[model samples]
Structure formats: structure tokens, C-alpha cells
Target: KKTVTFFLVVLLAVSLFTQNDMVSAEIKPKERSVGKKCLEITCTMTYTTQQCSTHCIQMGYATGDCLPKEAAKPQPPEYCCCYFEK
Candidate 1:
């Protein structure tokens, strides 16, 4: 009985954690555009900043970095992992 109870508790904990993770993962922040299209180029990230060489010519530039889009990066809104193509 003790073993069964312990197992049940562990199962419950795992299920709860998994549910929380799923909920957090599903939640996403909004995306803003910078208004430009950019050339396809590999960008470098320095301690100070990470930037791409492309012209960023898309009509709608992302509010933040145009690299990691929501679909691509999977992070919250502060940074823009997505970009609008020309």
C-alpha cells in the first residue's frame, strides 16, 4: 500500500509538471515587424549585439531581432525570432 501510494504520488507529480510545461510551451508572445526585407545572410552575434547583414528590406520589420521567429525560436515576445520575407 505504501509503495502504491508513493507511485501514485510520483505519477501525479510527473503529470502535473508535464501539464505545466505544456501550458507554458503553448503560450506565446506577440510579434512585431521592423518593416523591411533582408538579404539571406548568416548573422554574427557579439557580446553587445547580434545582427544580420541583409538589407532588412521587408515591408514589416520585426520589432526585435528578425531572426528567431515565433514558429522558429519558440520563445516569448521580447525577441523576434521570426521575420517577414520580401
Candidate 2:
């Protein structure tokens, strides 16, 4: 009887998790843009955002989206990971 109860609880938890995942799922665009080569570059921590932007253009991208890297530990002078299309 105890084993059966544990099994039922586990089953319920799994089912709830699956339902929550499905509810939160959304379709994503297949491609943000086509026929463009996308390049992702991470600038050194010493470089500022403005520098990164300049570097992006020099790397052959018209523009860039620069953001910091996400990590499990605290980071300082956050690095910029820029993505652009050539």
C-alpha cells in the first residue's frame, strides 16, 4: 500500500510538470532573417560597450546586439557578446 501511494505521488508530480511545461511553451520563429551570415563575438571585459560596437562594425556587421554573459557565479565588468549579420 505504501509503495502504491508513493508511485501515485510521483506520477502526479510528473504529470503536473509536463502540463506546466506545455502551458509555457511557445513557438519560435524559424529564422529571424534569411540569407545573412550571423556572427557572434564576445568582447574582452576591459572593453566598453562603445568599443564593442565599433569592433562589431569593423568585424563586417552593420550593427550588433551586445549583451553580457549569464553565468552561475557573479561577474564584474560584464563582457559583451555581440551578434550581427554580415
Q: Could you say which candidate leads in lDDT? A: 2
Against the true structure, what is each candidate's TM-score? Answer: 0.37, 0.34
| Model 2, residue 19: C-alpha shift (Å) | 47
Please, what's the RMSD in Å of model 1? 14.1
Error of 2 at 7 (Å): 78
Candidate 2 residue spans exceeding 4 A from truth: 1-46, 71-74
TM-score of 1: 0.37
Clashes per candidate (backbone, < 3 Å): 18, 0
- For model 2, the run of ten residues with the poorest summed lDDT: 29-38
Residue 65 of model 2 has an lDDT of 40
lDDT of candidate 1 over 62-83, digit per residue (tens): 4224342334565432222324
Candidate 1 stretches greater than 4 Å from native: 30-86
What C-alpha lDDT do the candidate models reach, one value each? 0.47, 0.59
